[model samples]
Target: MPRPFVIDCALSFAVAVSTVLTSVIAGGQAEQSPPDWVGYLLLTVAAAFLVARRRFPPLVMVLTMLVSLLYFGLGFGTGAFTVAPALAVYTAITAKHRIAGSAGAAGYLAVVLLADRVGGQRDVSEGNVWMVIWILVIVVVGEVSRGRAEHLRAVAEQAARAELTRELEAQRRADQERLRIARELHDVLAHNISVISIQAGVAEHLMHRDPDKAHAAVATIRQVTKDVLVELRSILDVLRRVDEAGEIFPPSGVEGIERLAGRAAAGGIAVDLDVRGRASEVPADVGLVAYRVVQESLTNVIRHSRAAHASVVVNVDDTEVLVRVRDDGRGVPGDDVRAGNGIAGMTERVEAMSGTITAAPADGRGFVVEARLPLRRPEP
Candidate 1:
């Protein structure tokens, strides 16, 4: 298909045509002239088969070889017809037909010799044999070069596809991270900001009439903002890489319940925590999810309930971790299930860890949230 191959094939055809015409012209002038035109015609057809060598090599090569043998038997110019078998030799090698190619070459030589012997032509020389061998060598080398080029092309295409796949995967991961950040900002930061805004307005109104209580309200706003900063940092740290050397913080776990309880207490929601478990053995990711579920559940209670006190009970066993949060306040109606983002977020976190959550009010009292998470840890 290349310019050089096209040129070469064209030239070979022209030569074969010239040989046929010359043999015909000579035979017309004299009866002893070799009747090699038939051989030249067969050789020309065989050489042209190279055009489809890449697409159907085995079939083309076989047909061409058969024509070349017939040409040789008819005593068409041995020299020109020799190109046919030689070209077949090249195609065979190119098609990775080592045994077939070699065997064909040997069979061709045997046929040429046997034909000459059977025809009683004892004057045939060995120069033709040398010429055919040289041609075969050149064709074999050309086929080798072509095979190498094809291999290199395949490798380049494979590498390009792999690179494209990697880039797409990376882009998909970035999009997912952005979605996660948006969800966290909407659920956690937005709720905290709303609470801070309402409390700040109350403090401003009470400043002249109730100075001590106003001061206490300002302190509550400051503490809430501080807690917001810590959580915001946790989210941002994933992007900022504050700790270049390693992970920034040990993952928040069941042990973190105490701090979470203290924060709720500071915000005027008395929270009592009773932890019973081998909290240290939980998977970091699962522990984080469990802790967030409790934190978010308590946040909802503080924002929605007029309950004076909330209790969190953590029970960890060999197979699973169970969390229960109950409050003593106005209860939801049995038939009226009020669904909110807080409950949805807790459910999402628990489900992500192969866990389940149940939300309902305690008998004749307040709301209760419970989650059960399976225990599965990766080896360090």
Candidate 2:
């Protein structure tokens, strides 16, 4: 059986035994007829009904009250016999059956008060006063228990909602971190690898006709390869991978745009890099993203554009930093050219920092990429 069933059974036994014994003792003190089997049966029924109090609290309270009233009205016993009924009414009140419990308690009090006024004295007796006190106690204690139960349930629900909010926040941060890492890898590999591809093509073409030029192209390939390794190591460092003896390479932000232009110029494309404002005034993150916007634009030029010249310009003001990279190549490709991931990555970065970017063909000329990065991010 359930633990509650066992407890209720024990409670019923205690009340039954106590009520019968007390009623017998009280009956002897009275001038009424001695206690009979009917009196014992009435007390027993009231106590037994308590066993199902939790399942049908209001019904149990009514049944217990009716039997107790019958027993008292017959002069079988009164004092301690009211205990079982009080307990039943308490269970009903705590179960939130406020109307039924109040009605039952009032009915019991009314009958007892009426009997007292009619039977012996017009003045209230000590027993009637005690009955009123018992009902007051049951209502007070039952209300307290119900209030405490409601408080605990509210606390539990609040805790669950807080946990769910924390989980969703954690998931959102994890997703943003993953996207940041992917963009980093794409920028580092695509730019340097495009350089190596161009140098390799130069070396392959000049190998038989001009050995010295071929040697220079080979040298450029070696230098570009070394840059790739250093950039890769920088990325690995962020993911907690460290080389015991490798040289650390700090990411060169806007300062490296000059070198970027140099690298492209060496690949036979005339390039110009201009800075119109103090780039250092902005946050490191803003500068880094500006650098990437330039880097990715140049890589696209080296890989796709058939023209020979490109220009990169960066302007910083108190509010925002602007980056513009234009190539004098075959203007933006036709409809047949499939889209590239670089533009999407750039857009994500700019928007994440509350910035804007545009990449399209210049009016009647080559392709142009422009991005405006804010110095200070806004509060969410």
Candidate 3:
């Protein structure tokens, strides 16, 4: 049997033995019939009801109430507190049947008080008043226990919700970090690789006729390769990072765009790079986006435009950074720019900084990529 059932069995035996002794003392003093076998049976049944208190607390409350009333009416003794009814009321109240438990307690008290008056004992004894107080104390004690249990449950639920929020926030930050890395890698590799590809083709073609020019082209290829390696290493360092606020990123901005334009100009293209406003005032993140836009636009010119000339204009203001790149090659593949790493990647970067970008055919010739990057990034 369960431990509680075993405990209840022991309690029932003790209460039965105690009631017999109390009733015998009352028979001599109060002129009441002492508890015989019939009274012993009633006491045993009332205490036995305590065994099922946990499973059916309300039912135990009702059953114990009825049995106690019947026993008290028989003029036996419970001069001290009755243990069984009090236990049943405690179980019911603590088990969350607070109202039913109160009713049971009230009904038991009223019935016992009525039984005393009906049995011609007009004066209520002090012990009887203490018994009534003890039953109310059990009710208050049970409510306090239930209140504590409820508080613990509420605290546990709040802790679980807080843990879940932390996990979701972590996941969101991880996704944003991965996306930043991807955009960086794409911008770095696409521009430099296009330069290297153009230089390789130049070196191959000029190898037979112009040996000096071919060697210079090969030299450009080597430099571009080294630049790509340095950038890739920075990204690797970011990946190996162990915590936040200590990430490694490429040291790139508008200041680096001049070198970027120089590299593109060396790849057999006439390029004019212009900055009309204070370039130093741009925020680091916005500067990075501007650099990427210029880089991607120039890469498209080198790979697709087939034009010998390109113009890159950067106009920085207090509110925004404007980038306009135009080439005198074929305007674009089509009127509407298709999605790719070229224009589409630039679009993603510009929009992420709460900026706007437009890539389409220019007025008469060439393709133009124009972007306006805000000074501040939007809130996440």
Best by TM-score: 2
Give, for candidate 3, the lowest lDDT window spanning 10 residues: 242-251
The residue-by-residue lDDT of candidate 2 on 280-302, one tens digit each, is: 66788888898889888888889
TM-score of 3: 0.84
CA lDDT, candidate 2, residue 100: 84
Which structure is stronger by lDDT: 1 or 2? 2
- Residue pairs that clash (backbone atoms under 3 angstroms), model 3: none
Measured with C-alpha atoms, the lDDT of residue 199 in candidate 1 is: 68
Off by over 4 Å in 2: 30-35, 121-124, 241-246, 266-268, 333-338
Evaluate all candidate structures by whole-model CA lDDT and list the values in order. 0.71, 0.84, 0.83
Cα RMSD to native, each candidate? 6.2, 3.1, 4.0
lDDT of 2: 0.84
Give the alpha carbon lDDT tens digit for every residue of 293-369 in model 1.
77777777667777789999998899999999998978666565446666776777777677889889888789998
Give candidate 3 regions above 4 Å deviation: 1-32, 79-81, 242-250, 331-338, 341-344, 377-380
Q: Tell me the tens digit of each residue's lDDT in model 3 across 1-380.
A: 56987887787677766766666667567655666667767777887787788889999888877777777777666433367788889889988999999998998888787777777675556767887889989999999998998899999999999999999999999998888888888889988999999889989999999999999999999988988987787778669863445434445888888988888898778999998788987888888889989988888888888889999999988788999999999876674576576787788888888999989988899999899998876678
TM-score of 2: 0.87
Pairs of colliding residues, candidate 2: none
